[model samples]
Target: MTMAENGTDTAAPQEGEQQQIQMQILAQYIRDMSFENIVAQKGLHGGEVTPEIQVQIGLDARKRPVENQYEVILKFNIESKNKDSEDKMFLMEIEYGGIFHVAGVPEDQLHPFLLIECPRHLFPYVRRIVADATHDGGFPQLNLEPVDFVQLYRQQAAAQQQAAAQSAQA
Candidate 1:
């Protein structure tokens, strides 16, 4: 057991060629983007005051017809409304997608890789889109906080397990 130059252990080849692990981004694009400033003048003035902004994040992965290829999408739904009034300030929605080539990753690691690692690679771009959309919509730049996809995935897994357990007991 010896450490490789990159700090990962490199095992001597046993009987066959070593496994290849690769994840490559073929392309990345904004699938959909919409920004609406509902109230023009009022919203602009109201925007001066702090608005209540809500953001939602979603991730999806689907296998492509091509072998070892998958499409990963990061979706965002952001809305801001006047803090003191019921009037709407602005609404923005974005869907950012990337085509990834994944190879040599085991089946057990596939789902986690797609959901956690793939999205981790795609999040910064999505965050920038949200900020730009808000700024273009005549509001102060709305910089979204960094997301913790690993924690989110764990929570989702726990919820699914609980639901399955409840169904089995029913």
Candidate 2:
């Protein structure tokens, strides 16, 4: 019987084998980042402005494969606005990507490594950049806490499944 038919290849390397996994930052740049310090100037001048700030965070990810290497990007956007005046005070977007050279890993383990471990490794740098940019833009530092991507992925998947089930029932 061929390896394909058995769902397990005998020639596949065992877990913890001398597999090579390399994580490299091929390119890191701000795909787009914007910051508006409308309130900063006004506040400095003692102008009448509300102190309330509204922050919105967005997350996105994409995967690219080149030969045997994989490039995954985790994009984030943060927008802060003054709720009362409906004026945007701050906006920042970052696209962080890492290229991984992974081999001798079983197919089943690849998904977790890419979606969870790889992103976890890259999050600190991304968070730092965002915080620094916001601070340098004359606004308060925007230090975002680390996220549990595994739990997030599971929650999202569960929500999707629930929605699909409800739609089917409907």
Candidate 3:
């Protein structure tokens, strides 16, 4: 059978091989969420304020108590500011989680799989929530661009590696 670069077998399994990789989203929920309309809070009425938005993402994954179950949490921190004055316009924070039942993936690749694949499944929901929150906060709806999970994973991994190397040298 062919093996994929991510360490999963591509072709069908031969006799006596393990079952195919399986992943299912058993449950998904917004664990915590908050939206702040800083413009209103600060009473900042402006003249043709241009917005600059920053979005930050974090991911965490842990194995659940039950076998083959895992919990993945995707965290978002979004802030918008006036491009000229740099005054904060709005802030949105959310923690979205999913309970996944996964099987047949090798342990070596499970971490990347969870952090990358699971977030893709939950990003649409997170995007919608952010848009709704901004709209309800008296601002125009903010539609987030699609995330590049693979690139994010690679960048995070590189950062961690750099930190580890620096610490080791110290």
- 2 or 3: which has the higher lDDT? 3
What are the per-model C-alpha RMSD values against the true structure?
Answer: 4.5, 8.0, 6.2
TM-score of each: 0.81, 0.64, 0.89
Best by TM-score: 3
lDDT of 3 by residue, 1-170 (tens): 68899999678768888777999999999999999888888887878999999999999999999999999999999999999998999999999999999998899989999999989999999999998899999999999999999999999999999999999999
Total clashing pairs in model 2: 0
Question: What is the C-alpha lDDT profile of model 1 across 103-142, one tens digit per residue?
Answer: 9788888998898999989888888888887888777899
**TM-score of candidate 2 to 2 decimals:** 0.64
Best candidate, lDDT-wise?
A: 3
Model 3 clashing residue pairs (backbone):
none
Better of 1 and 3 by TM-score: 3
Report the Cα lDDT for residue 62, model 2. 47
